[model samples]
Target chain A: MSAFNTNNFSTNGYELPASVGASLKPEHFASILHTPPPLGFFEIHAENYLVAGGPFHHYLTQIRQNYPLSIHGVGLSLGGQNPPNLQHLTALKSLIDRYQPAVFSEHLAWSNHGNHFLNDLLPLAYNQQSLNRICAHIEQVQQFLGRQILLENPSTYVEFTQSTFTEAEFISALVERTGCGLLLDLNNLYVSCRNHNWEIQPYIRALPLAAVREIHLAGFHREIDPMGEALFIDSHDAQVDDAVWALYKSIIQQLGPIPTLIEWDNNLPPFSDLLAEVQLAQTILDAYNTLPAKAQP
Target chain B: MTFDAAWAHSLLNPDAELPADLRVWNHSDPAIRFAVYRNNVVASLIQALADSFPVINALVGDEFFNAMTAIYVRQHPPRSPVLAYYGADFADFLQDFPPAASVPYLADIGRLEYAVIQAFHAADMPSLTTQQVQGLLINTEKLAQLQLSLHPSLQTLQSSFAIGSLWFAHQGAGNIADVQPEIPEALWILRFQLAVEVLPMSAGDCQFLQALLKGQPLGAAAESVIEAEFDLIRCLNVLLQKELITHFHYL
Candidate 1:
């Protein structure tokens, strides 16, 4: 009954050129504007630019003019117990309209509960209740935005005892039900797999990879869990780990060059350093570009 | 409590029991694993406060600031997920925080820092052109009845302590030792072009601007400034030069 034809929504039409990009940081705004770097596109956290108007918008407006953008939302809390915040959703719609980004994405995890926004992506129980809640929320968001959004898999620390579906199965159902796409974050995959002792390849194979329109690569902090097993924290501070890069290479080899992004949020290095990481991902993407097209999953 | 409510409660309250439903792969104690989320929630909110109030953090040092913000984070977790405007109540928190009572000027600094952030993110609008301002200024009768609209970013703060000098001291523009914190100061903050500019304001100018901000007409605003040293020409000139006057219309 609504004006939007939600059934036709697909991320395939919104794919960025098969190349690499970096998270747009305020520190690197000047350099990015000084000379538009040789990157495919820049990804920005939607919450960072949710303000009315300022340097964030000022610089992003100019940068957006030159580069294809991916607006990544961190605050939607799609998996929360309640439905998505209508006010936040309205703000997101305005931002989407203003920017008209190539791809819009959000995490699968919930960051808010009740009146408090936890400020970190928290894990959710992948049971029927949560799945129903998340699917309904995503459907609302998609209908409100009138476009398909890619839900990035979260890097979580713990799992819930009540979980019925595996994380991959939960995500696959989300895509199937909401007609949403996946923003496959390799760093998160590595971190979650390492923390939970889940094998990486099986998890990847379980995901609805054909819905993946974008990929993210970031660094993680290594710590020890209470069980004395190695724990990886999804800290976006350091350079992308070599192991994550290996995972990314394999994913790209199979998927054949997705829009990969280098996300370095905290303790940001110079623009050159980020570009160096972008170059690394770009190297992998470029290598796959030359290969014969693989069969779509 | 529902699992979500219990988990949310435990995240902000350090001493609260962890949600009963949390689990790890090895069946090991989930306390440490769950602490990661608790730590992340508190530490990230604390970091947001520290980022917004760096001068306050520097004045209080890391250990004190972190500890104080931890309590504040628990007391007032952000209602919204946009961390950019998360610390709106931080200044008020510092005012009543017992540990920070030693630094009496700390709350004022928090206010200034918060104001700077507000000004930095306020809606962008073009300032009235010089010609347009002059065109209005020449009509004396019209000017008296005109209600001027300042830039959305313009903010004024009146502090009993020398917040402007203290802020400048932290910016390396002035010697910290030279700052006399006892002196009362009125500060004007606005984003001129891209940079947020902070300047010391005279008492009379502060009153006049505050009145103007409240939608008082030019003549009424000028009359409200009871300070003997209030120079109408000087304040008008500054407003014109700084492009703070965004628009004006006859009352």
Candidate 2:
């Protein structure tokens, strides 16, 4: 076992209150540093900062001092056939210790198999066998980090014929068994429901909504399947779609304010554009914040 | 084969049959939906390579680069999930790629680009100041036996082609037409604070620096390149200016 005792490490009391944030992009480092925006927190892909040290660490160190951070791991392969990688866990623990992020999350998808890491979030069969494997992985990760991790729902293109449990059932089971939280990605919920023809509201209601600790909203690309049915790609390139925003508003109204992040990864626009999206989310959050306590969830 | 092994195999190999027990709600051809994952896996890896080797992408047009990296991606999928260090073997791959034979310098450029990325992400260490260096130089006898530690971000690449000029050309600092590819060049790459700087160096200075990086004492490294016109003061000046030397101790 590693020598890191999570009890001894202090997270500096940084808390990500219910508000809006944005993905911390390298391009916007200058703007973020010069004029810090009124954001609840900032989220970063854990793999990007896995290196020993560099500007990624340098800037993140400075930026983290002012903002509550959320480290999202895209490479843990939580749903893979094998257990999580030990070295990756060690690195992740060190990063958490260094930055003391308020929250850490990963996907319910698998990206590694054998010796190859496919870089894309691949779908998994939601069966008893797979569920057991994922539960063990999540338990190991939580034990190693000494904190619960939020598993984000994946935006997958295909479904497995072998899956016995619905996506919501599988996620709910994982949350119940492992004592983990849910990172409700509204864009993913919208995209997966459209792709798989699953009912959106029912799917959201089916999930253990009370366990949702954070939310993600991003834009996706549109495509057509062979049957001429619409398919949405979670591309994270454009502005959040109107439909997704409506879904987010509905969720916020029901669940009250949650830590929301505007994720724009590729074809990045100026910092102001991301701030605009942040402002959009903040408006909805602020609206909910001002609501009477009795009216809130 | 197990489902994971089968699925992984099919993702990298287009011809491999899609893993059994895959479907969509429509039950239409799953191949079309499966193609999305295939495309994502291959295209994202190719994009990672393109991100790391932009000069290589520019040298060979996007069409050629994409096609070439497609082949490389299938042959060498990333072993680690860190996409930044995905193309460590790309330079060697380009060396033997028959289609890229016309551009012999492409492989060298790939190596240079990779080094730049490595330096960009290397560990941060406090560099020695000029005053500290001057203080060391004052003790001539002690300096000869002193072993200097270079900054964690310093990288030295010696190439037969004008790699430094070619890289700069792509960055809009110079014209590509003015680059004499056949002219030999040695490159010094290091990150000062936040920005990564790539500069050309003489062969003699490069050898001396390389020797110093290999833990050679200051006097011996300087002596090894003396016949190559290695100017100790000029080399020290550049090192001090760039804050490359991080620590020094007498052997």
Candidate 3:
């Protein structure tokens, strides 16, 4: 396996064939790999291909030759007090070396402590301490992988009273310190906003749009607590909610056509069904991309 | 305790108090908020265990399986972020677990399933080609020095019960209730073209393979099996046909 050279790809240089893609599913590997979907890219969870040899790596290697790849991780624990785990970091670095994904990204949350990894993207209190800890962690990760990564805004069901910075401010600070980019998750913005009765518009407005490189659109599930208070869950098990789609369209219109991913992790539908959703994102991206050069801001 | 420690403790133990440092934007009691995180953590780990040990889950119905996994996960949550490597100690844990005392074979079943899962992710190396293992001779000197190499994905599982039967029985094998506990069973678990195959072996074949696994040459292994009147040619044919022997050399 050869290392992916990040220098070869730039937003202004060689870009991904299509702006819209779906996270690669094992069920769709045969279809996508054999036919090689035109203008389609794939995103994968880095942990799934950590092993030395398996069907997962075989297919990913084959599919990678044609389409662009994005490596999304779930285990960085960037906001934890302890420094990032060296073993995990080494494995992630090996992956980056093996497959130079067009882009690499992880959550803006912590999922590890001491030696054990909790295996869930636990929420963090957005304060000065966490902001500093995460920036250092992201910098360490970037230095180790030899490339800057995009930190995504996480969806949470709760907030800390001790939080001194809003989620957007915290992300902005990390970007400023590390010179990293952002993978704006529109579904998360809507889910977190509705869960705490916060305004989505202001949160989106506060973000540094120029630093935004990719966008995530996914489905959500609704739940009502025992006390009859409504709560929305960011379960990527269904079609993208109409509300999240609306938010996504607005972000693209404001930020221009950034590469967007359609994440369907659970209750995965057929290949055609997932592609249909990808096409929907393609439609939105196409609408923004068609504006004349003189029609710029 | 620090915020992360307190937060992890609360999530691990549903009965634990909400961390004083933990708070929600809207309300004071954050118990419901805690529940959402707790649910995600517990449910996802249980799903991991079930996915790794589907045979165990099927042998014991979902209700009992879910109950067992729920207890097992809380007592021993994942220590690594890689969900693929989770539940390695489940078989050992089930042996001492009180609720599982009724089924002594349960531990062995779990052991078999864990191997199957591990074999799927084990390192890949090409098996020996046909030209490698040419012939089996009756001469003592020639056979004494030959050592067979197994593939990285090849593993042998020995259990006191018919775990292979129980495993297949769960996979639409009929009349499991009528089956009875029998002698020890040995299974050749390996990955064949992206699929895990569980091949049951007779006692003589298993002992011969076991001797081979211990780095013994063909003469010693053959002598042991020959004492039991095991057919050497037949065993070699099965092993050769399956491509289990990656390569062989004179010791």
Q: Give me the candidate number with maximum DockQ.
A: 1
Write down the RMSD of all candidates, one decimal each: 2.3, 3.0, 3.8
What DockQ does each candidate score versus the true complex, computed on alpha carbons? 0.83, 0.82, 0.62
Ranking 1 against 3 by DockQ, winner: 1
Complex DockQ, candidate 1: 0.83
TM-scores of all candidate predictions against the true structure = 0.97, 0.96, 0.92
Quote the positional error of residue B211 for candidate 1 in Å.
Answer: 1.1
Scoring only the A-chain of each prediction against the true A-chain gives TM-scores of 0.94, 0.95, 0.93
Candidate 2 wrongly placed segments (more than 4 Å):
A1-12, B129-131
- Model 3: residues >4 Å from true position, as ranges? A1-18, A225-229, B135-141, B173-178, B221-235
Worst 10 residues of 3 chain A by lDDT: A1-10
Predicted candidate 2 versus true structure: per-residue lDDT over B1-251, tens digit per residue:
98778888899999989989888899888888888899999999999999899999999999999999999999999988888888999999999999999999999999999999999999988888768878998998788898999988887888889889999999999999999999888878899888899977788888898899999998889888853656778788878888888899888
Highest lDDT: which candidate? 2
Two-way lDDT contest, 1 vs 2, winner: 2
lDDT of 1 by residue, A1-297 (tens): 322234557443455878998899898889888888999999999998899887989999999899988999999998888889999999998998888888999988888777789888888889998888888899899888988988999898888889999999999888888888899999999999999999999999999999888999999999997679977899999999999999998898888878889999999898889899999998887887776555433
What pairs collide in candidate 3? Answer: A3-A97, A4-A100
Could you give the candidate ranking by lDDT, starting with the highest? 2, 1, 3
Model 3 misses residue A283 by how many Å? 0.8
